[model samples]
Target: MQLTHFNASAKAGVSRASSRRTTVRVQAAAARPSWFPGNKLPEHLDGTLVGDFGFDPLGLGVDKDKLRWYQQAELVHARFAMLGAAGILVPDLFHQIGAGGPAAQIPWYDHAKFEYYAPINALFGVQVLLFAWAELRRLQDIRNPGSVNQDPIFSQYRCVCACV
Candidate 1:
């Protein structure tokens, strides 16, 4: 008896290797920062993205260029960590999706748990974005299925990716 896995490059059903490494390579190539994980979107609902916003946090309405390093680093660091966290959770998350439950079933919003859903949704949305992207790519792996696709808000990461 044999268990075979496909080489990521060419086709799904291909050759067999004793120990093939796919996830690590993808993760390494992604090179996501420990501080900011790729899965979490750095942007907020206000459309203000990570680090320094183009506008002002002080209500001075200044540009990101005007901000200091520590301030910017703080946000940068948080965003990076969330992004990485999302990616790390991908494997098992997808497995659960495939089994029988969809993402919506998860405790995304425990109405009983929160007096408000806005901020919670926002933070969770970032996490969801990461899960969403993974489930989209690996629907088969998801324990329960959810219609996975790009969350337009989180797509801002595309720009961040280019800048980095």
Candidate 2:
């Protein structure tokens, strides 16, 4: 037997050579980064899949600025990373609702862990930010005569290790 798949545009199922070609084209397209500058929203999340009542994990309706992954990470760090060290293990209620939607709908706080909680969550994807924060703290602490800065907020923001 042979595998077969639908060719939606043709309104029929395709197999063998034609199917293989379509599959190849699709795979190639998928591999490429589709992001184009000036896009108002992410292609992956267009607010159609989940419907209006549901939440789009990648697409946020309120914020018009479409940011790259790095920009999103930076925004997360600037807004909440230090707070993690300040003892806010869970993100604020507004954050939970805004980025990922209601907790009952999806675990927004859990998802924000990587962005808001640095170093510990660094390995997940925000290593550069964590490294920068750690390095800055290390330099500051060196002159301040403490292993980490004495400031309540800054001290909490210090990385687990000084070496980064």
Candidate 3:
């Protein structure tokens, strides 16, 4: 299912439990399941509904215990990468291109223009995804011995570099 859909469902679930809160411990039992407390974030937060607080994958407002150390680090990396990529592209490329001013005069296939920028952005996005997947593989390895394998993305990178 789509991440957004999952998030919505999780949010609905949370709201439903929250709305049933009374002066009883039923709310606690309804909100958090037995297995919900100890499993890794991906096990629980994979379908978590987040709010407007910057891509809340786990719906965790400020509770840092929801995610493990590597997951947290990866989230931080992703946030910074997104900000940096947007910071450069929005102002330097998108804004200029959208404005249709002197920047538009530059050829699309120029050395430092859209040609290189597009490919670099594509590569960066793929690399980021690969890195995140590698982290997931690490988690899997921890769960089951010898579960992780060599990263295919890195192998592809090597092959492409060799060809070039």
Candidate 4:
């Protein structure tokens, strides 16, 4: 004797209850992770990013565009910091090894006291201006990607000056 819901009311009631339970389970499974029961992880961070561990306590990086911008900014800052470290270390290392001449004798801190000739000063000014222009162009590129045709080989006049 098999017990079946032959009655229309009984079948409808059972189906509704099961469907409701399944819906709730699906929502719970999709939203919250097992480790963090309190906070529901955002749907966007699906553990695919470089360092994504799904640990967004502050709820930052919710916007995809802002997140990408932040990532790029971090990379740029990190690269600059590495360059600064190298800049400090290389001169000091050369000084310690007794390789460099008069310039190396001056410690990194006291290098500001060293006087430069007019030509050198002019060159430094030109370098600063060129760096500023490049930085502005890079900033524009970041703000509007593909806006600056940064093709080093095939840029304006095809001279490859930008690559240098």
Q: Which candidate number maximizes lDDT?
A: 4
Model 2 over residues 117-164: C-alpha lDDT tens digits?
345544655767777886676456544546663444765575454342
Better of 1 and 3 by TM-score: 3
Q: How many clashing residue pairs appear in each of the predictions shown?
A: 25, 0, 0, 0
List the candidates ranked by lDDT, beginning with the highest.
4, 3, 2, 1
Judged by whole-model lDDT over C-alpha atoms, candidate 1 comes out at: 0.46
Clashing pairs in 4: none
Candidate 4 lDDT, 47-85, residue by residue in tens: 667766567666678888888777777888899899998
Between candidates 2 and 3, which one is better according to lDDT? 3
lDDT of 2 at 5: 71
Runs off by more than 4 Å, candidate 4:
1-42, 55-58, 116-132, 150-155, 158-164
TM-score of each: 0.20, 0.18, 0.22, 0.52
Candidate 3: worst-modelled 10 consecutive residues by lDDT: 1-10
Best by TM-score: 4
TM-score of 2: 0.18
lDDT of 2 at 69: 37
- Looking at model 2, residue 62 earns an lDDT score of 39
